[model samples]
Target: MSQKPRRQKHPKPPKNWQPPPDDKGTILVRRELDEYGLNIYEFRVLAHVARRESKAEGCYASQAKMAEVCGISQRTVLQALKTLCQAGILRKEKNEKGRTNIYRLNEGSKWKHPSELEKIRKAEESQEDELLNLI
Candidate 1:
């Protein structure tokens, strides 16, 4: 009997990504944790949440589940989750049963990407210069 290869929980994207046939959308998130200056663990949790979410609906995963996948304790997961929340990258809702919390990416958040920092800085400088001129 031949054994089949086990499925990976997290699979890397292919070298060349081709759009889906129907163009519904792609959910393959292989983003680096530091893309937005986020901590690695926190971003891992964020990625996990994003993986489970759909464009139409925000999704939730249990702390235990995240911990199990990330090889960390529930406490660590919670801490990382909280960090993401405070950074405006994630929003959490307590489940009614109190088993675990539901998390979703705050995609509408004011949090700017690293690439936007320079543009924001320049804007602020211009604004300050205008203010100085008025003064």
Candidate 2:
């Protein structure tokens, strides 16, 4: 007997399908998270935390959870987090009950808002003006 063609195990997301919209704070955090000199693991961990951040509550993620999501050991996650906090790229605080840590992204001089891209344009304009003045 001929067998029917097997269906694909998992369907892909539609082209228009997107991850849940990030909160305003997350959008701002994403723009600044890369500025910190983070190794690959740290970057991944911070990105996961930023993705989970809510505008109302900020970022709250556990080391174990980050380890599971990144497929790394909890120790590695902890080290990365420590580095981030030391570098001032992230701020970590114990929760009210001291159960888990809450994280906050440090806003940088650059990429503070959606209009930050405009700052680049302004810089370009000023440079061009300087060149024109020199001419």
lDDT of 2 by residue, 19-115 (tens): 7666755344443445534567777777877778776676777788777777777877886776566555678877886689888877654223434
Q: List residue ranges in candidate 2 displaced over 4 A.
A: 1-36, 109-135
lDDT of 1 by residue, 45-117 (tens): 7778887876555665677777777766786777777666655667777667666667777764445455654
Task: Count clashes in each candidate, considering only residues at least 3 apart in sequence or on different chains.
Answer: 0, 0
Query: Looking at model 2, how many pairs of residues clash?
Result: 0
Q: What is the C-alpha RMSD of each candidate to the true structure, in Å?
A: 15.0, 16.3
Task: Kindly report which residue stretches of model 1 are placed more than 4 angstroms away from their true locations once superposed.
Answer: 1-34, 55-57, 112-135
Question: How close to the true structure is residue 51 of candidate 2, measured as C-alpha lDDT?
Answer: 76
How much is 21 displaced in model 1, in angstroms?
Answer: 13
TM-scores, each model vs. reference: 0.53, 0.54
